[model samples]
Target: MTFPKRFSNLPEYAFPRLRRLLDCHGPGGAPLRMSIGEPQHAFPPWVAGIIAEHAQEFGKYPPNDGTPELLSAISDWIARRYRVIVEPDSRISVLNGTREGLFNAALALCPEEKAGHRPVVLTPNPFYQVYSVAALAVAADPVYVPATAETGFLPDYGALAPDLLDRVAIAYLCSPSNPQGAVADKGYWADLLRLAEKHDFQVFADECYSEVYRDDPPAGALEVADEIGADPERVLVFHSLSKRSNLPGLRSGFCAGGPQSMSRIRQLRAYAGAPMPLPLQRVAEKVWADEAHVEENRRLYRRKYEIADEILGDVPGYRPPEAGFFLWLPVEDGEAAALETWRMTGVRVLPGAYLSREVAGENPGKGYIRVAMVAPEQELRHGLTRLRGCLFG
Candidate 1:
């Protein structure tokens, strides 16, 4: 049998591996899932109405890049949220979800080779899996960097050897980072933009969790890019309505960057991209243009943050997330904590290690569990209580 060698060495997908680790034993009590970050709040009421109104457009093929209305809505959101103006026609492309855009952007922009070396794709050790896969798909060397409490859960690319940086092609950064809710600020973005300029690489900023936070909103990449006066091509930003509007199933998101970079992306996507259906695009236009639902969603997450602090505040090493809807609770070992929590309280949470790859003599997430505060308030409180009791009690 012949198989592509590139994918042969890939690790098992996270969930199946999780199943193998925990499914043998029955959950100790009624299940309380805090594993995935899927939002459980109510989507805006207008979604259905907009969908029904535009349902007739489904008879025609969706525009590959996105309809003008959809792109304009995204542009408006960007302008309002980040104070950066991107021409919807050239700088933005709608995505089925940020994940697809993130993965595809790597393929579209990563050079075939860099400095006569296999280009390196820099990724956080505990990263969204797609980043690594995208690097592999493009035959680039994926270099996992540590993003842990020791570094404020943000990868410090500057620390990489100079030789490595010279060959680096792209870097993936997540603010209000997944599985760990650390938000990168203006200074962090500034330093990164400077590094990108010096190294001549692009940054793929995953800001999907931008809307769920505690205090002031996390500073965005485009906002920082503008401050630095860097070439627009230097950075790409991906944002989604899934977390903000509680509409994950809608699969609507946008990626925006310099016109040249986006043009390449759209060119590739024209043949390969799966456009959001016209009906869905119409609904998304409304979703992006309206901030009421997003505000309401943030209020719900704020409540969860308060609940988490009250329950876990006293525990040593308990650092409440500044942004995003996750509790990256420090544990003795992520696997042990996850199994013990499951066995004793039936609170299903993912081991932080599962979201990470062992890199450069470390697995950054090995000593923590990432709990999503996405359940309803009552269920969320119950799950948090269970987690605290089992892990810290």
Candidate 2:
């Protein structure tokens, strides 16, 4: 039997590749995992109580778009976070998780072809794997652009040829970027918004890490999009409670965009998407309305940030990220550093190259490792100290 060719060219997904590379090896000391970005902070204590209180609703089908209460909560959070008002009915759609929305948006909106040719979807190197897969799922050409130290660890979309731009249907951008922790500033957002306007492409902003930061909160794409008077449908921003609210298991997130685009997305979701359970949506509504838990979560991450800075600060090429819980550290070779750390200290971190694809003979993440700061403070300290002693010592 023949399989689809689209799936043929893609490399194995990151975790499977990591297991192949590391599962054979045994930890040399007490094991400490800093590889994946799963949060370890305490999720809100009230979550279980809330879910139990509303459990009866589980027997009924959930609202396909969102319940009024859930939509209102999401809209309120957007206003509080970005200072931009989004109408519950028109601007917001509850997602199973941001990844679902991010991938499906491409299918629901991308045309079969663009500019009389195959469409292109631009994504940053070291990107969340979903971006490239979404491009391929839609049969569009996925273009990986380098987002390395030389580029402030962010891709330069403006450098692509005009002809390429003309064929671009969408561009996926992650601020407080995954693995890299590079936050795009307001100016960066503005420039990208302008480029999208000029070239006629949509921007998908993955902001799941917006709440985890070192200092001032990271600037958001919607704010900048509004500031520039860009077309409302030109940008769709995805946010998740997974990192921000320490509730990954809840699988709640949202997508906000212009009325027409969101309508199309909602229509597609109506046919293929699973709505958040009614009870879960109730809990999420309350979670979104409250900031106290989020503040506490951020405080926990901040301490870990300081500990990492103190431990790894003096090392060459160590720059703390402005936002997000991962540290992207420079090394001579990412895979070598990862293996060495795992072999010597039992500290497992992801090689940055695994998070990125090679483009133009250079993998943007070829010489770095991504350490998740999502573990407990003491655990993080141990992992960092182990990592420092094993890899940099």
Deviation in Å, model 1, residue 195 alpha carbon:
0.7
lDDT of 1 by residue, 63-173 (tens): 989999889999989999999999999999999999999999998999999878999999988999999999999999999988887899899999999899999999999
lDDT of 2 by residue, 1-393 (tens): 989999898888877877787779998788888898888899899999999999999999999898999999989888888999889999999999899999999998898999999999999998999999999999999999888788998999999999999999999999989888889999999999899888889999999999999899999998888878889899999998999998999999999999999999999999999988999999999999999999999899889889999999999989988889999999999998888888888888888889988877888787999998888888889889989988788
Worst 10 residues of 2 by lDDT: 14-23
Off by over 4 Å in 2: none
What C-alpha lDDT values do all the predictions have?
Answer: 0.91, 0.91
User: Per-prediction TM-score, please?
Assistant: 0.98, 0.99
- Clash counts per candidate, in order, are 0, 0
